[model samples]
Target: MTVLALEPQPLAFRVRPQADECFDSWIDRVAAAHETTRPALFRHLGLEAAIASLDLARGTCGLSNEQYFAVYQVIGQLAWAVEIEVQQIEGTFLNVEASVVLPRRQRRYVCPLCWQQALRDGRAPIIRKEWILRMSWRCQVHALPLCALPVADGAMSEQAVGSWLSGAVARAESLRWKLGAHPRLVEWNAEGVDTLVRASRKRFKGEKKAYVDRFQANLFHFAHDRIAMLALAHSRVGKATWGFERLVALELPGRPGREVMTLQPPKLPPRRWRISKGSLRPGSHDAGVLDLVLAYAHLRVRRDA
Candidate 1:
């Protein structure tokens, strides 16, 4: 059938089975879907592992009690360590290693002046047109950023430096994952609790901006949305709580945020639900719900085609 003709059909057949789905399975699926996106730090599985690991560590570390966000901060440190190592390796080898191996791949270096100039001008020089660094870090030349960096001292070709740096970053990330210093609350004592609380509180506060900076950062990683959902699921309209609305307000980007929608209660007449699908981009099911809600509530606006 033609694509346009199938627009209104229910997608019951395409819904993947959620039965017995483990956390690892979900992680794998998420990683596979977003591996190609920009901002390497955000897409890296190490970040997730760091959070999950830290959470697991909190209870064992002998802290006063388990604070989910506290553990999340520890994971961020691991991610930062990986990033720093990668940048350091890239800068260090750009001048000496004309060619290098990064993990399973081989790379060559490029010119130093070219890269430096590009960096200075904030524009990435087009050496064969492939980006050499993260787009965000590229140099701006002619009002646009350049995507490649020249090797330091011209000792190695650009490609080689890039590969070497990539390899270094990968190795560091792997090592960080294996280090595992997370301890649980049960493992700590009164003194340990004081120390752990101070340390963890600082860590949590430090990451406040990062937590609220992006939708996915807050939703998937922060776990605030899920907690909020549970609260809203059980709350009634007049029984509003302090954090109840805030939870509902923090919707994932590109989906409705803070907007009221029909929330179907499990055992009663469907109540309005204000939910943002957050990174779970809408498909056929979403469209149907929108249609049903807007039609029933008289909120659907017709437009001229």
Candidate 2:
């Protein structure tokens, strides 16, 4: 099947009243970009959870809504990487540079139900408006949101990038704190630490300590294990295959944006392995690293099968 053929209906909507309310506005913009059926519910659940957590966090840090949203924007921008699928058609794939299809005017482009109906009918949905005209300067396909958009000269500095990265890392760390540490996380480490921490914190408000503790521990182990598996798996892509046991013993970094070369916990038993370059998966590691891990895991599974 063509890449487009396999693509699901995207959730789409424009953020309403783009002026003051940063968090609400982001929810709108993200929802617009998302275009799936029941877009509001998805937007609400994800955005609301993030907002609620921010409120709690602010109790300790004294964050303003704007500040919280600013951090949220950073998280939104860096937390998911995007992958562009360029497929060869009758000949080779086009080598054209991709650009933002800016929107001509502020308007609602797609009704969620209508788009779903079209997808259900097996018709390929065309983004009818010119891409750049339809999108905001804030929107970028392959790069992270908010920060990835083009800026005036020297507008986005290395220091700014560093700040964004640091914030992202801190958020991930918070999530990890809630979940508790695990060998699995150590195994395929990515930036999901913050997400895990949040999950754990959200648990057990009304449950028994024994059950809550057990569940939280289980979640920690699961989260850590899956992330670790992904890290170890990614490390082998384009590289030689090692036995599954060998994979477990492998040490990889557990943060997003961390290069594979930087994950030096210690040496493992000597075993043949392959190293692949330029095969990172976008949006996998809350930035890009975890995506590599997932891609590697897929390759391993195929080889083993």
What tens-digit string does per-residue lDDT give for candidate 1 at 1-305?
Answer: 65653222221222121222222222223333444321243324333433443212112243334454454453334324333332222221111111111111111212333444555685432231111111011112211212122235524555685565455334323222322111221122122222322333332223333322221111211222222221222223212221333444455467754433543212334445432222322323223432233232222111100
For every model shown, what is its TM-score relative to the native structure? 0.15, 0.19
**Model 1 vs. true fold: TM:** 0.15
Worst 10 residues of 2 by lDDT: 86-95
Kindly list the per-residue Cα lDDT of model 2 for residues 113-137, writing each as its tens digit: 3223445686422221211121211
How far out, in Å, is residue 29 in model 1? 26
